[model samples]
Target: MSRSLSIIWLFGLISGFNIMITGNTLNYWLAKENIALQTIGLLSLITLPYSINFLFAPIFDSLRIKYLDKIFGHRLSWICLTSIALVFFVYILSFLNPFDNLLLFASISLIISFFSSMQDTILSAFRTEIVNKESLGFASGIYIFGYRFGMLIANSGAIYLSIYLTFNEIYKIFAILIFVYLILLIVGVKYFNSFNVIEEKTYSSHTSSSHLHLSLYHSNTSLCHSRTSLCHSRGGGNPVNNINFIKRYYNHLGKSLSSYILKIFLDSRLRGNDIGKSENDLSLLSFIVLILIFLILYRLPDNFINVMINPFLLHLNYDAFEIASVGKFWGVMGAIVGGLIGGFIMKKKNILDSILLFGIIHALAHILFIILKIYGKNSTLLFITIGAESITGGMTMTAYIAFISSLCQGKFRATQYSFFSSMMGISRSIFPIISGYIVVNFGWQNFFLFTTIITIPSLLVLLKIKNKLQQ
Candidate 1:
């Protein structure tokens, strides 16, 4: 168990490191070189792959590398390939002058983002495959710890190291670290692949690729039968019968294919709903819709408040150092502790109960911000408020990851989880824009109050679907 958790943690760490290097560290380097602000803004195009990788995520699910897939399992094979590719590109980028080789630098950076995003998708599926459902919450906690630690190194650690090291040297060091971690990852993958003991229950009938293929075959077969019966009734000689059969065949094919592709982006349970009649009509669709709504809303309170936090603190006349101390140092500590506690709860209570408990606590944690507002910038109160917020944020996020992991137990786990994650990301990105507007119009006190109120809908959504999800 320790070994497995270590591997999971390392996966998260490496993912975080690579993403930050390509994003924050690289952007910082560009700025230090006196790149134009407009050009620097355009550099966001390089990281665009992360947002759209779900479009190509199915490739990792269905395609297998020649030699690597035979050695590592399908998911791990893709992970290994992408990891090595990421290291290669990062190392290459270390040698290029961004100003001299602007096109090359941008191309390589985009490739790195592409591979990094692919690695993330494959790693999520791989993690889901290796860890049993019972330990998902704990595993996710450890992963988050490693992820945040890695991000710290890339952001704060790299910035501090810049006093002694050039950007090229930093990139080289990160490339080397990634390579070394790859070796550890290979050993861990081997270890987990050998066991083959952890088995997860499927969430719906359309969970696996085989199930999907079977459904398609059955649909086509049933259509053919129905067409043949019509032909027989029409004396089996009319040209219209054959034309009608052809039209219907293509029509059904289009719908099935369209639904299959649509399911990749929209709700994953759509395929399950379309494939066959459920024991309770509309139950599965309602269940998934409820969960999706919950997922989108569950973390809004946390995210909505977080976007305005630094600005809010600065507005309160707190200096940068004080905010960094509480927000970065102590805040991270609080989150780590909360994650572990969340894991314990998930391990003991059923997931629904655990989610409900976390949801309530998460909502209440927002009230601390209102208190912080009332107390002014006192260090003790700030620490208490930030500490509570971080802890609950961490706990809520861990539960969210665990909850999604539970749903993504299918053959297309990578694609399913990617789509779900993309939805969450969309919510996180859009809500913050509204946060700024609210702070501008309503004042900080009302904004914090609004954040607290926002949690109620998600909690209600969770309760509405609890009985269905458990099945």
Candidate 2:
């Protein structure tokens, strides 16, 4: 790879890592702080602001960051600002104890989440600008790997550290780590300047709407000619004059509209060879139900596990350290490995097939939890169950990520992906709340069974989209 591409990838890694660290660590820490389980679900509300970025992406496309785009450039400046803000916010959070000041902690977390979301938007747009279409899948893999590693550090490493240190200390250490990431991001901003600038200018000019304006002007000319033709046909001129006018009108209208529409569609290219012959080919509306089913069902087992696992551990008389250790070592590591493997497989295999297979494996993995529930909290069983769940979950996640990436067109990649990812966040956020209720009312075993049943709809959706996915 070129030096600029390498820098872009590194920035992606840093951003991914930063995002995951908080996501994985916060839950465990929140529970340890004695917050209600229901409130933990509400913590996902912090990400709600990110949903607006999708709505405003077109504005980002049109607006420049003033001299910042000329100074540090567009993508880099936004990324740097957001990264610094995120680091500052996280550091501030290190000082507040959630127990004494729940509002303060919640406020800081929301701020961090907002900055993190903006960072993600800029970083994703930067990646789309720098990386070639062919490299997107591999780039995504690297990102997920880095992200999962961060989770490992936060979930597993932090838990291990907590055995010897206080939660406040761990927060400070990770805050320092976030600062280190900020430094790396600054370096990336400098390194990527030359190559990314060229691509950005090229893409920007090509996707500009000047051509569309010209096309509309030509269409207006055609409409004028058509009016003239009608006047001639009403005995104002010779028949030949009428025919010539009508011919010119129809020809100009056809050429202008066709060219303009074609340009609009072709502006956002897809992954494969065939470009924009039909917009419907790229539309996911037909599969909205499929996507909904996939989201709800694929995540059900994990959601149930998330809700009940901590309480179940508490009930089994396992301490926070043990649960954190197992979750970090087995769960985090397995997810990273599975994500890497899934990304690799997607590079060669059909995405739909991969999703189906992983979904099936994920559904089957729930059986391990049932076994664990029956056998009761042996460390070995806990590790084994977590490992199985994480691996399958990772696989499912990787496939889903790749599938969503494939669905996005070049122009709207960031916005479209953000929308889809936010949908995922919504499901993830809501599932836990429902799972909490289920664990309280239905109990753990029945919850797992319900999760298994939910997987059926996702499987059917996979079948529905199988052929299109292969294409």
Candidate 3:
């Protein structure tokens, strides 16, 4: 694997840890603030970036700071920059008292989520360059394992550390950790890019005239006066031209997009290469439509529960430490097990088939929570509910990610995947907001039953495309 792929895996850990710090570790803190349940449920709206990063994904995919990229390479430079932004925004969170300034806290949360989602977009694109589509299941598994471990640590780790440190102090500690990570990551990326620069320079020197001519044709430009732009970039005379060059590149590619996108999305079919089609889906348009339906409904149950789980547990008289340890920490452990199982299952089975199988388990896993709500707080029951939900959730996520990876456009991997993921996040974010209302009016048991009921539409969509979801 390339250094870039390795970096993405480790970044996954950071992403998991940081993202969960809000969703799980600080779950009780946010709930305990006495804010209205409706406002707390709408917290998923802060994560809107996860669903909509495609709007700006092209910027990350193409544009870069010329000066900074020279030192850190294109992707790494953005990663580092975004990571810094993430640290700043997250640190700002420590200073905001959610109890007194809830709206400000929510605003800060939105900004942090934007940066975190951007980091994820860059990392996914970086990984696409190195990891094979067929291997993405295993790669996602490995990534999820590390990600969930960080979640485990953050969930349990932060709570345990609270015995000695205040919540503000804990936030500061996390900020410091991010800063340290940024420094080390910069050093590593510098070496990696430097090595590539050397390798490319040596190789370019020995290229035959024919190969060099082919490179010019492939670069889609004629004004290459020197060999540097052939491999490095298209800043022939001035760095400013690079922006125009990228614009032309994408505009031209957009014109040349597959009939699938043009016909399905733009209302006209022009002959062109199939840009985002995978091995199984001959009609990428239909495949993606079906996938979108599935994506929108895949995790409705979980998102509904997630909005109220902490408050529900608190209602049952569980302390923050208990929620962190049993709910967050042990749940992560279950996810790790599920990640392993999910990886193996997707490796052996078709991605969509795996999704169907695990989606069922994922939907059914809610029964455990319903059980917990019914039986009240038995430690055994608590562990069982958390464990079952975590395992199925992890498995479904692995399969869903693998399926989405298959849909990412070859050239526009970041933008395309962002759109798909954002489609899914639309459901995730909206349903959670409604969860507050549901639990408040209809009660937890009825809300959970509704979650289970909503899972049917996604399964119906999955069935519509079952034949095409094959290996």
lDDT of each: 0.65, 0.61, 0.66
Model 1, span 187-236: residue lDDT tens: 87676544333222321222242111100011211111100000011112
Ranking by lDDT: 3, 1, 2
Q: Which ten residues in a row have the lowest lDDT in candidate 2?
A: 210-219
Work out how many backbone clashes candidate 3 has.
1
Query: On residues 1-471, what C-alpha lDDT tens digit does candidate 2 reach at each position?
Result: 555555655655566566654565676677677676567666656555565554434333334455666666655666667767776787888888888988889888878877776676656666655555566556655655565555566666777787788778887887788778767766665764555554356444423321100000011111111000001111112344434545553454356533433333354443343344443533533444455556556666675566556556665666666777786667777887788777676555666677788888888888877777787778888888888888888898877765655554445343344445666766665556666566667776887787777888877877866544346
Q: What is candidate 1's local distance difference test score?
A: 0.65
Candidates 2 and 3 compared by lDDT, better number: 3
Worst 10 residues of 3 by lDDT: 209-218
Could you tally the backbone clashes for each prediction? 0, 0, 1
Give the CA lDDT, 0 to 100, for residue 298 in model 1: 84
- The TM-scores, one per candidate, come to 0.59, 0.71, 0.76
Q: What TM-score does prediction 2 earn?
A: 0.71
Clashing pairs in 1: none
| Residue pairs that clash (backbone atoms under 3 angstroms), model 2 | none
